[model samples]
Target: MGVVSVSLLRSSVFWTVDDLQQAAGRPAFAVLTQNAGPLQLKDGVASRRGFEEDLSALHEFITHLPAEFSTPCMMFTSTLPREGSSTIVAAFAAALARAGSKVLVIDGNLHHPSMHEAFGINARVGLTHVLEQHATLQQAVQTVADLPSLHILSAGPVPPDPFALLLSSDLRGLLQSATDRYDYVLIDSPPAGRFPDAFYLASLSNVVFVIAKYGIVQRQPTARLLRKISTPDLLTSGFIVNGALGVSE
Candidate 1:
């Protein structure tokens, strides 16, 4: 299946909607036209200028979403780890919060949780604790000091079997509770190609975005992952191309 949309981030070389349309062989539904620089955060607040154009594009995309999806919950995953999916999630969530939307970012990457560190919060009491009934949702969710509208639920301690933990009923409950409270809920999951966790998370999200590092990520695996996760109920909003050198004709 063809991609429904495409977002580019931190490209070392420039790219335009025309360039991406030529590369994808179809018009993009929404494209982040600017070359986003590395995400900059000072005391947990994202720099507006660093992601302004990207944020504008994202806002435009969200604004055009179907009306039924009033409080959309989105997930970000990649073909492989360290493909900058986490950074993308963080930047986008921060942008939403800065724009006065109450946003919650869940560090669903149970095996490798970095959202806590990214937001300068304690990871000890988070999603795992809430899932296990050791902590309440209120307790596990931490508010970012600099960005009051932003909240985070870190993955907490790494579990013996991250996938098994994700299977618990509490995850759905947590998501339900989150959607009831936040304007947007963004989840960060492990690499979709290497783990089933991403698929599971995709099933629970309103929209899914696969992150692919430009030069490092191969097309076959990424395409395979996208095909596997796309479904009628879930809007597989296509993928983000990160750190690209340049687009070739």
Candidate 2:
């Protein structure tokens, strides 16, 4: 019943995490991917099948994440523009919230903010306001009626110096405060290899999830970028390939 099913057709079409684990002897990512159909993006949100697949993949990834962290702040990033990191973070955050986790999504990509656009909300105030002391987190946080547990911190008005703002001590304090209040803090940062802002956010987060768009992300540069940001304390949750197997680029 519900979304869970023992039947193969229902299981593959809806969800069958238990059956997947029993059948595949591996994680749910591969199984979900196999069952996923083509996806279309409308207003920055993935189609149903694609969204479900991404949610399952990310959920499985989080399930395996070490339980040592009491409050996990995960940053989703990519090596280049148009890598679908923002879309993934948005959908992933919503999925987490729907599953009863309190998730705070911080739009750290000040250069080209997309959370407001994706959620169709006016970005009158956001992270910049909080960092600049113009607004408190409670004031900056925007909530959607449908997703009660998910909150968004838009990039606010794009500042003249985004890098400077992101590196500010206030930003660090905000991250700490957010992690304390929320079950998971999902940060959508600028491209990893192209912008220093991503590295800064990644340093502050306990987990880093890299998105590599198929065909768009070259192997060598991504490798170099990963090595550059690699840290012992940071939990790099490995790469998630966007547009995997004939999906749009």
Candidate 3:
């Protein structure tokens, strides 16, 4: 077993990467509903019924991860836009933090940056700056006040060349650094069918969670999207049928 370090952050517990690796596997894909408006994390607590249910489900999923995914670094994307993938990814991070694990959520969807807004933080400096060499990793990460164990690297200023930045070598370095620092790193990527960026991000992930909104994403297209990404053979994959559990949209 790897070296495990555990610390109590106020009422919540925080664990080091070694601890998570030895304790259990990564979480499974979860299908959650999209809030009609926004997810408010006042004091780092999620209050909505749907949100709480989803968080609990995610916590349950963590116990059954495969051996290969014990130290999971994964990405979440959808077949189409507005499928509630970003929201699910955010909830997953919160769930991990609540479990007393150090979590890092990176906004890799440069096309639509929402992680910063979700956490109510300034997106002035993040992955973009770090990739461009304008800022260091320490400068780009924003620590959540309510969840001391959760850190966010928002998608900074919209670059004119989004793909170029994502494909840059800097991203690989940053990702490696994150792996060493955080117990789990969840990246929120853009829709797979709409942009190629998701493919690139998925390549770096240990597992990929594809979200398909019920009544929104058709079955045909979802199958096609899955087939399209199977070329390199994704490390591990799962589906989150949004609204499938009768959660409000």
Candidate 4:
């Protein structure tokens, strides 16, 4: 997310906002609104619609993500959730749709999930149900509107054993299933210090990319924690600094 003016979506003149933002030395992946509010046009304040500028930039961003990584597995973390991992992952999925890639965004942050909220999906049935083996894939998967190729599986009601579920064989099978169904599986995991659920999932991913805030403290013990996750196969490791909250903000 980044500063956004909905009206700018309609103007070919504003198409280069991506380059401008990237030039600012802090490029962002924006989850812009579908509606561009009233703006000055020849017919007076008019709504802007049918523009793909923001979405196109987002597509470029997520499409190149896997290619940039050393492995297919990607681990994303935030110094904390408020720092922006969920937003990034969800938007990344949305943009991935634009890039002609079929993507499934799993809300792996069980303690307090946000994928459903970001996508405006019902939180009653999803990955939680699937992991519990209580729901079929069709019953759990929700298609993102306006983004035909992007699907979301939110972590439903927080289960008592999110960690156990992370290590469940069912999860592994699900990942395998996803690999065959989609181009990429983007998971929105929890903060490193908040829980170890993500660590377990990261081990299964092709690559793991971490997330750090522009400025935040990670109180977790570094060496011991790193040791627990040590693995030669873990690749495509990187960190992103995010601060934006909403498109209009």
Model 3 agreement with the true structure over 49-101: per-residue lDDT tens digits: 66667556656665567766665778888887887777777777877888899
Q: Which residue ranges in model 1 land beyond 4 Å of their true spot?
A: 1-40, 43-45, 48-50
Colliding residue pairs in candidate 1: none
Question: TM-score for every candidate vs. truth?
Answer: 0.83, 0.80, 0.79, 0.66
How do the candidates rank by lDDT, highest first? 1, 2, 3, 4
Where does candidate 2 clash, by residue pair? none
The window of 10 residues in a row where model 1 has the poorest summed lDDT is 5-14
lDDT tens digits by residue: candidate 1, 1-249: 133233333232224434443433332333333333343356332454434455566677776788888888899898887777787788888888888999999999998888988888998888888878989888889999989999999999898998988896468778989999999999999998888998999988988887766555555556667777876788546766665434442
Give the number of the best model, judged by TM-score: 1
For model 2, where is the 10-residue window of minimal lDDT? 31-40
Residue 144 displacement (Å), model 1: 0.5
Report the lDDT of model 1 for residue 109: 92
Which prediction has the highest lDDT against the true structure?
1
Native-to-model Cα distance after best TM-score fit, residue 15 in candidate 2, in Å: 28
Residue 219 CA error for candidate 3 (Å)?
0.7
**lDDT of candidate 4 over 39-75, digit per residue (tens):** 2222221112422444455445544664544114345
Estimate the Cα RMSD of every predicted model relative to the unseen true structure.
6.5, 10.4, 13.8, 11.0
Model 2 C-alpha lDDT per residue in residues 110-197, reported as the tens digit of each score: 9999888777667989999999999999999998667888899999999999999877647778988998898889999899888899
State the C-alpha lDDT per candidate.
0.74, 0.72, 0.71, 0.59
